[model samples]
Target: MNSPTAPRRDDRPQDDRTAHRTILLRGGDVHSPADPFATAMVVERGQVAWVGSEGAADAFADGVEEVVDLQGALVTPAFTDAHVHTTSTGLTLTGLDLTGARTREEAIAEVRAHAAAHPADPVLLGHGWDAARWPDDRPPTRAELDGATGGRPLYLSRVDVHSAVVTTALLDLVPGVADRPGYAPDAPLTRDAHHAVRAAAYAAVTPEQRTRAQRAALRHAVSLGIGSVHECAGPEISGEDDFTALLRLAREEPGPRVVGYWAEQVAGARDAEKIRALGAVGAAGDLFVDGALGSHTACLHEPYADRDHTGTAYLDAAAVASHVAACTEAGLQAGFHAIGDAAVTAVVDGVRAAAEKTGLARVRAARHRVEHAEMLTPETIAAFAELGLTASVQPAFDALWGGDDGMYAQRLGTERARTLNPYAALLRTGVPLAFGSDSPVTPLDPWGTVRAAAFHRTPAHRVSVRAGFTAHTRGGWRAVGRDDAGVLVPGAPADYAVWRTDSLVVQAPDDRVARWSTDPRSGTPGLPDLTPGADLPVCLRTVVDGRTVFVRPDE
Candidate 1:
C-alpha cells in the first residue's frame, strides 16, 4: 500500500484548489434539463462539470476529492429572490414580530412587551401589523401606542411598509413632520411623511446593529436555499451607509450573493455614475411611482372603493419618461415600484416614450424592471412585452391580499381585484417574470413563493409549478442581464440546493397538463409535491459558486 502524505504546495495553489474542489453528488435525483433521468452530478471550478445517470457517474467517482451521497434527496438550482430589503429583513427577524397579533389591543400588548424587553434600544421598532386582517379592522392609534410605550420613541410600520404609525415621541424626532404630505397627527404616515419618519427611525440604528441585522438576514436566506437576493435600497428606504455596509458584509462572507439596486432617478451621466459608485446594478428598485394599495395610497385612475378619492401619484408620465430616457442614454436599467393601474399606465407610457427617443432596440436591450406590477392592464402588459420590461413580482401579495374577500378586493372591489397579479397574462404576452418575497414584507420562503405562484388565488393568474420555479430561479438572473446562471447545465454557475422531500411529482395548472407532463416519454423531471397543505421541501444543503454556504444541522 502507498504511504499517505500531506498535500504538497507544488500540486496547485491553495486558493485555486479551494475554488475548484472536485465533488461528485450521486444516488439522488438531479433536477437538470440536460438529463431528466440524471441521478448524479459533478461540480468543479465553480461550475457544473457534468450531469448524467448514476451508471455514468462511475467514470468520475475515482477522480473527485469529495462525494456527497444524496440518498434520494432532490437537487435543484438554488432560488434567487429578485427583491429584498436586507437590513429591514434582519431587523424584523430579530425584533418585535406583530404579524400574528390579530387585533389592535393584541398588537399594542405585543409592542408594550417588546419595549419592556428591550429598554436599552433607543427606538422601539416593529412590523407586519395588517389592520385589514384584524377583527376590528382598525389600526392602533398613535396615542394608544404612546400609552403602550410609556412615551418612548416607537415606530411600527404596516404590513406593506408604505405607511406607519409612530408615537408622538418618535414624531418629535422628525423635524416639521406635520408639514409633510400624507401626515396626519393621529393616523399612520404616508407619502413624504412616511418617507421622512422612516428615514429618521432607521438612522437611529447603529452600525454594529445594522451589520448584525444584515448578517442575520443573509444567513437566514441561505438556510432557505436562497443563493442570491437583490437588495432594494434607496434614500427614502435606507441610507448609503446601511446599503454599502450590507453589500460589503456579503462580499466578505460566504453567503448568498447580493445584487444591489439603488432606487434613485437618473437625470444625466453624473447621476448614473453616482448610482454605480454605490455598487448598484441599476438605478432601479422601490423608485416609487406610487404607494401601496392597502394603504389606500396606490395611484389609481378611479377612486378606491373604501376611500373618497384617487390615490397619491408620486411621479407622472413626464417624470417617468425623463428618468427612463436618462437611464437608457446612460446605459443603466431604470425601474419603478408601481402597484396600481394608473401607475402601471405611467410606466408603460414613459417607457414607450423612452423607446422612441433612445431607439426601441436600445431600450429593449436594457431590460428595465417594474417591481410589484400587480395591477397591470392587458394594454400595459402588451406594452411591457413590446418594451422588453421585466416584471419583478411577488406572488405572496396575491396569496395574502388577493381573492374575493382580501384586501385588494376591499380596496378595489371584486371586479378589479380579479385582475391583480396576472402572471399568466404576463407570461402569455412574453413579459419576463422574476419572483421575490419583498422580504420583511412577506418572507424568504422560496418553495412557498413558488407554490403561491403556482396556486394563485385567481385561477386565471395561476401558472404551472415548473414555470413558477423557473421564474424564481433563472428569471432573476435574466433580470440582472445574466443569461448564463441559475440553472444546473454543464457550464452554468454551480449554485444549487439539495432537499429532503417526501416525493417528487410533476404538477401543472390542470389535470390534463399534469398527466401529459408526467408521461414517461415526456422527458420532464419532477419537483417536490407542492399541493396546498403539503409539506415544503426541507433544505439539506445549499451551494453557491461551488461553495457550501449552508448545511442543515444533524444531516
Candidate 2:
C-alpha cells in the first residue's frame, strides 16, 4: 500500500530507508512521453523518485549509489503487450517459423527443413503461415505437409491462430474429429475441430520443453523494450498447466512481469472460484465469442463475400451477459475476444443486460475489457464508453492485413473492410483504448504498433502519434487496473527502456534532430517517429520494478 510519493523499503538505516540505493540516469532525453523537458531521472529501489535536468544529478549524487551516462539514448517507459500467448509465441522462437514464406511451396519447404533437423520429434508443431499474401492465396494442405514430414504427425497453425492444418497421422490421434463441426477432410481445421487438433499436437511437448518455451518468450519481451505482458490464456489456447507454469516462472524467475487471465466463460460461483484458484487477473482474455476473421470463423452480421458461410459463434448473448454479470458480482474483470460486427453487437447487448442485473457502477468498477473489438458500429462504441470498457486492440493487425488489396478486402468486400478497427472514432466516443501486438500472430513491436495506429489504412481512423504512444504505454497499465504503473513520474514503478536510436523524425532536418520532442497541438511529447520505413530504436536496457531484466552486453 505505497502512496504516490512513498519510496520502496530497504534494510538500511531509518534516515536511508526512505530513499535507498538511488541511481541517476544522466545526459539523456527523458521523454516520459508526458514530460518532454526532463533530461535526467532518478530510480530509487524499484520506483522513480525524481526527474529533472542533467545538472540536478549532483544534488542527489551524495545519496545516489550509481550514476550511469546515457550517451544520448532515449529513455521512456517500457512497453506492455495487452494480448499474447506465452508458450505458443515461445515455441515459434525455437520451432518452425514461416513468416518469411512467400508461397505455399516455400512454407512446406520450411516444414521439411525442420523435420530433417528433428527426425525424432513425436509430433511436428509450428505456426505462422499466412496464405492471404501468397500468389495462389492458399495454405499448405495436409497432403503437402505429409510429403514434407514423410506422413509423420504434424500440426501447423495459421498466422491468425484461428485455423490450422494437420496431417492424417496427426488427425488419427484425435479419433472421429473428421465428423465434428468445422472439419474439412484434409484442409485446415477451424472452430471446435481446430482446438482439438491443436491440443493433440501440443501433447507431444514435455514439461521441460514447456518451461524453456516460456523463458524464451519472456526474455524476448525484455530485449524488445517490453517490461510486462498480459498472457491471454485459455483452456483451448493453452491448458491450465501451461498457465500455472508461466505464472510460477514470473514469480520465481527474473524476467518480464506476467499478468495472467484465464479466458473462461464464467457463469456462476464455481467458475469464479476456478479463476481465483488460478490467481488470475480476470476470467476473460480471449474467452472466445467467436473465432478470427482470417479463419473465416468470425461471427459477422453478413455472409462472407467470397464464401457462403456466415461464420460461427461460440457464445451467444445470454452466455456473454451471464458471464459479465457473474464476474461483476464477484469483483473480477470480464473480457472477450470479439472480432465481427455481429459479435460486437452481441457483446454490447450483453453488457447492457449485465448493467441492468448488476448496477452499472459495479460493472464499471470492475473495469471489464474486450479484445479485438475490430468491427464495431457507432452504437457499439457508445455502449463501450457507457460501460467503461477497455478496448485492448492490436493496430498491427491492420498494417499486416488491411488496406485496399489485403486479406480483409478479400474476405469482406472493399467497402465493408474499409470500416474496420476505428481507433480514432473509439477515442472520440470516449472508449478507453490500449494498443498491443498479439505477438506471434503479429510480431511484438511496440514502435510498429504506434506507427500502424498513426498511419492507419483508413485516414479518418488514424490517431495522433502521441495518442498511439500513450495507448501502448500508460493505456496498457490502465487496462489492467493499475493506474499507478507505466509512467516515469515519482513513485511510479521504475519500469523503463533505454534505446540506441538515430533520426527521431521521418524527414530529418539537416541541422537538428527531433528526438522525443512534442507536437505543438497537444503538448504531450511523442516517441521517435515510428513511421513504417524509419529505423526503430534498439533496446540497450529494460528495467522492471527497479531490477535490470535485460541489458545489452558491450560488444
Candidate 3:
C-alpha cells in the first residue's frame, strides 16, 4: 500500500458569477468523475459554483445560506435512465407481481390471489412471468388462467414486453387476435396479437389510474437518485395521449424529468414534425427494427441454437436508411431497437448509406442511436464508431439474461451467448455508450447495472468500475444531446446525489500494486470499492438543479 496523498486545489470559486444565494457542501470525498479529487462543492443559482477541498469552503461561504456536511458519504452526479416505460413499470410496482412465481401452478395461483384481492377491479393487469427457469418450462394455459380468474379479464406480460398471455376475456375484446400473427393458445402473444391485446388492456385503464401509475414510477426514480429518464413510447407500444400526459405531468409536478421519444418509424419530415407536435424528442426509441433475445424475436443472421428460426427483422437497409435520412433532414435524432446481428447490420448499413447521401457530419450531429445493440459484429462496432452513433444499452440485460448457462446461452448456445453485449469493444472503438435499465423489462437498479457492466460474465468483455460509472452518468447526458451536465464540475447543473457508502476512493489505472488505496503523499485517489459482494451505495439525498428532489431524514 502507498502512503496517503495531499488533496488537489483547483481554481477557487469565482464569486463574480455567484448568485445572491449559495450552498456549501463540506467534509466528504467527492468522485466528480472529471476531477480525480474533489472533497466539497459550492452550488450557486442552480449550477456548480466551485469544486475543491473542504478547507477552502470558507472562501466560497461568504454568501452561503446552507452548509451541508456529507459526513464522509460518497457524492457523485445523479443518474439518468436513458430508456423506460413509465406507466407499465409503475403498474408492476403498485399492482400484481408474478415475476417470482417459479412454476406454472404458482403463476396461476398468484393471479387468482391478486384477482381475489382486487375483486372490485374490472380488469387484472400483471407482468413478468418467465418460464425459462421453471422445470416444466411452460406458462399456465388460457383455460387454467380462466379458471383462476373466474372469467375476469387478465393480461400478463412476459418478462420482455415483446410478448403477453391474454386471458380469453381479453381475447374476446381483441377480435381477430387468433388470426393475427404471434397468437398462440398456450403461449404468450407476440407481434400483431400482442399489440392488439396490449391496446385493449391500456383502454381498460382509467385516466386517473394512468396518472397515478405515471406519478408512482417517477417518484420511485427520484428516490433512488435518478434525475431524469427518457420514456420510450410509440404508437405500437403506447398511445399518444399517454405519452403527452406523461410529458405534461412531468412539467406540472416536481419529480424526475421525463424526456420523451415517439419510438415509431416515420417516413417523411412531415411525419417527424407530427411526432415533435406530440412533444417527443424525436420519432425514435423502441422503433423495433427487431425484438428481444429472451422472446427469441431478436433478428439473428443465424438460426437459434434451440430453435430453427433465425428471428424477425422488421426493416432492411433501405428502410433504415430512409428513416435516418428523413430524421437527419428534419434535424432529429434517429434511434432503433435492434438486438440481433442481422438487425444491427441493417441499421449500420442504413446509417452508412444515409451518411453517404447526406453527410457524415450531419448524421453525427443528429446523434443517431440504436437501442440494445447487443449482438454486434466488429464491422458493426467500427461502423458505429465511424458514424458517431450512441448506444442506449441496458447492462442489467446481461446480468439478468447472460452468462454461460443463463437465458442467452439457453437461446443461442454457450459459444454465441458469451459474446452477447460486448461493452468493452464498443467503448474501445470510441462508440459513445449510454447505460440504461430499460425498465419494465428490468428494475431500476443503477448500482446493480454498473456492477454488472464492471464485472461482466466474460473477463475479456468486462469494463472497469470507472468506465461503467462514466457510461451510466456522463454518457447518459451525451445521449440526450447535451455536452454539459452529469459531472461535478464548475458551471455545470447542480444535479447530484449523496450516497451512504463504506469509503470514497476512485479506481486508478495503476496495476503494479496488488491493493488499491489512496496515497495522500502522492496525491493518488480511487473510485468506490465496488468489487463483487460489495454493498452498493444507498442514496441519502438527491439534488436536481440545486433543489432537493429526494432526501433522507438526518440520522
Candidate 4:
C-alpha cells in the first residue's frame, strides 16, 4: 500500500511539527464514521491533534490562532473514492456529456449541440450515453447516428464504459474496424470495438485541454469533499506516459491525491519485472475478467435470459491464474473487473489457485481487489472471505438500477435478478468493502453514494448509514493501505467533511424508508434534520487538510 501523492499546487511548508497555524473546529457533532460521533476537533499542521468535546480544545490553544464555530453541524471524515477514472472524469466535465439522454433522439440532439459548439472539422466526440435505459432498448445504429449529426463522425459511449455507439463516418475513419470479427455481431460496439474508437477520440485531446479537464474534475471532487481517488485508467484508455504525466501534475498542483492503476491487455506480459517497475513508479495494474452487464457481456454461469449466449470472458482462466501468480510474486496487488456470477467465480478461483501456489499469507498482504462484484453466488461470496479479497463497488449503480422494474429483471429474469448487487450479503459474509463513485459512469458525490447504499431498493441489501459512510472513508483508505486517512484520530491527516445535517444514521420508520418522501423535490431520503422539525439541508462548507482547500460561499 502507498500513500497518495500530494497535490503539486500546495505552497504550504511541509514542516509538520513546527508550523505556526493552529485551527480549532468547535461545537460540531463530529461523526468520524470510523468512531462514534464527537463534539469537536482540533487540527495542527495538517494532522489531527485532538478530537473530543470542546473542553479538549484547550490542549492545542497555546498556539491556536483560528477557530471555526460549526454551530453544532455534523462533521465526518473526508471521503476516499476507491475506484474512478480521474482524467476521464475530468475530460467528461470539460467535454460533451450526454448522461441524461433517455432516447436515441435525445442523445443525437446532444451530440449535434456539442458538434455545433465545438465545430471540429474531422470528428465530433462525446461520451456518457446509455441505451440500456432508452425507450427502444436498442443502441442507436451507425445509420441512425449518421443521420443525427449529418455524418459528422460522432462517437458516444454508454454509461458503463464497456460499450460505445459510433456513426458510419467515425467507423470509416478506423482502419480495420469494419472487418473486425466481433464488430457487427456484437451489435453495439464493445470491448475491442469500443477500444478502437476511444483511442482515436482520446488522441484528439491536446495536452493543454487534457490538463484543464483534469484540473476542472479535481476542483469538482474537492467541492464534493472527496480527498482521494484511485484513478483506474487502463493502458488502452491512457498510455503509461499519460499516467506518469497526470500523476506528476497532480503532485505539483492543488488538487485531490491520485492513485494510478494500469489496465493491461496481455496478462502474461505482467511479470515480476513489470510489477516492480509499476510499484517503483507508484502505479498498480488491473485486469478485466469480463465486460459489463449493460452490454450483456459480464461472463455469467448461465446464458442471459433473453439471449442464447453466456457473457464473454475477456481473459481466459489460464491467463487470469498466471496474472494472479505473477502479481503475487512481484509484490504487486492485482484487481479484476468482475460483474457477473461467472466472472466472479472465475476470478475467485483464479486468485485462490494463485494464492495457494504462492502461499496465502504472502499474497494476502498485497490486498488484491475485485472491482464491481455486482453479481455473486453464495459460494463465490464465501470465496472472497476465504481469499481475503476486497470488494470495490459503486453504490450509485444500485440507486439508479435496483428498482423492481429495473434492468436486472428486464435482462436476467426474476431468479437471476435476486443475486444482483448484494452489498449487505457480501458484508455479512466477511468481505472487506471499499466504496467508489466510478465517476463518468456515475456522478462523484460521496454523500449521494452513502444515501444510495443506505436506502437500497432491496431491503435486505440496504446497509446502515454508518457502514456506508465507513465504506467511502475508512474502508477506502484501507483498500489503498493508507492507514492514517479516513479517520479523525490524533496523528491522522486533517481531511474531514462538515455536513449541515446532524447524523447520516437513518431513523425513519421502516415502511417509509423504501418509499420516496412526500416531497419528491427532496434529493436525499431519510436525511437527519438540519433544523429540528425541518428537512436536512446538508452542504460542504470546507474540505480541509490542516488548511482549507475548498470553502463554501456562506462560510
Best model number under lDDT: 1
User: Using Cα atoms with residue i matched to residue i, what is each candidate's TM-score against the true structure?
Assistant: 0.96, 0.93, 0.94, 0.88
Candidate 1 lDDT score at position 481: 85
| Predictions in order: lDDT | 0.89, 0.84, 0.83, 0.72
Lowest summed-lDDT stretch of 10 residues in model 3? 1-10
User: In model 3, which runs have C-alpha deviations exceeding 4 angstroms?
Assistant: 1-21, 33-35, 510-525, 553-555
lDDT (tens digit, per residue) of candidate 2 on 1-555: 111111122221222332345889999878764465678999997889998888766799788888889988889899988999989988999889888899998999889999999998899998999998999988888778889999999988999999998898998999889888989986789988998999998888889999999999999999989988999998989888999989888877767778889998787888888997986878878999988889999999999988898799988888889999999887778999999999988888898799999999888877788999999888899999999889999999999989989999999999999999999999889988888788789988888888888889988788877678779888888887878777899988888999888844322222122233333344344367676688888899998777777899871
Residues 1-555 of candidate 4: C-alpha lDDT, one tens digit per residue: 442222222343344433336778887677653334467787777778777777766676767878888887776677888888767788788877888888878887777777778765466767777776888877777777777787777768778887888888777778998665348743678777778877877776678777877788878887888877788866666765567667777666655667667666324444445533552212233467888877787888888887889878987656667777776666556778888888888888888888878998766676778889898878888988888788999988887776767877776887677668888888889888999978888989887787788778776788766578779888987786566677788888777777776444443334323443334233222334222244434556545466565666766
Worst 10 residues of 1 by lDDT: 1-10
Clashing pairs in model 4, backbone N/Cα/C closer than 3 A: 8-251, 8-252, 8-253, 9-252, 9-253, 9-254, 234-263
RMSD of each predicted structure: 6.0, 4.3, 6.1, 5.0
Per-residue lDDT of model 1, residues 52-141, tens digit only: 999999999678988999999999999999999999999999998788988889999999999999999899888999999999899999
TM-score of candidate 3 on Cα atoms, chains taken together: 0.94
State how far residue 377 of model 4 sits from its true place (Å). 1.2
Which runs of model 2 end up more than 4 angstroms from their true locations?
1-20, 505-523
Task: Indicate the residue-level lDDT of 357 in model 2.
Answer: 94
Superior candidate under TM-score, 3 versus 4: 3
Clashes of 2: 0
